[model samples]
Target: MNARVLVAYGTKNGSTAEIADVIADALKEAGLRSETRPAAAARDVTEYDAVVLGGALYAGRWHRDAVRFARRHEHSLAERPVWLFSSGPLDASAGERDIPPVPSAARAATLLDAREHVTFGGRLEEGARGFIARMIVKQGRGGDFRDMERIRAWARGIAKEISKAGPASPT
Candidate 1:
């Protein structure tokens, strides 16, 4: 697909950004033009044919920058194909699917008629923390649980969707 795809993310300790980078790479491998950027720093979505918005979850909430970006570009996003993803479950063995930290923020998906909303495993490094997060890490719930294969599969799915819709003309 020749469509340009944006893999924008909001991360606290940079894990989510890493995931976004992998997803962007996967999209490129699938023959789509893709770029990754921090949601807070992304200028505008008007130039992209499709978007994949992702963020890290904390305390039952998605990173604020992702939510703000979705809200700020609701109308523009609603006009194009959009996908939503959340990464925050530190334990992949817990079978934690559908644990979106900010379901309300996912309203952007509804507004845009999004193709999918996925929740992937996350990572918690040894020393990365923010106050209460340190306590959670002490509980032995820290490690990298991100599945690169799963992430790549999801990006391929996005590429398929883009291909099905054909290239989108800039709005």
Candidate 2:
């Protein structure tokens, strides 16, 4: 049985989108069928056997659309196997050990029965910034700090869980 995984993301400078794609590819490579799409563009979660929700974090919060998506579909999502991920904390100077901590958004989602939630490092494009974002970047901070190895391992774990469970209709 093929597990249908929906990898949805909300991005500003496209970093989160790229992460979503990576996750989708990993899922596919692990023998699951996956689709990556923006949160706003997602049709419905009912058709998917598992859902991986992701979004870029800004100012210690998840992108608004992602939060809204989760709220709107909380009931439906609670009925299935769900996971969440975030792209934030571009400061890699902390190495892999001192990346502050996972913010409340990721934590709250985990409390909602998410199988897993990861905080991958985010990115900052040179010209892709608003006034506040620009200021943050100008502070000698901000750059892509995504850890692909960790991401791959996380995806592999999710794939294993889904494969073991097989595919099942929600409710």
lDDT of 2: 0.80
- Stretches of model 2 off by over 4 angstroms after superposition: 93-95, 98-111
Model 1: residue 81 alpha-carbon error in angstroms: 0.3
Q: Mind giving the per-residue lDDT tens digits that candidate 1 earns over 1-171?
A: 588999999999889999999999999998999999999999889989989999888887888888888888888887788898888888884244565436755665676677788888889877886976677778887889998888898898889889989966655
lDDT of each: 0.84, 0.80
Q: Model 2, 1-171: lDDT tens per residue?
A: 589999998898898899888899999999999999899888688898999988888877888767777877787788789888888787764236644324655654855578777678888857766787787678867677887777777888999999999885657
Q: Model 1: what TM-score?
A: 0.91
Note the residue pairs that clash in candidate 1.
Answer: none
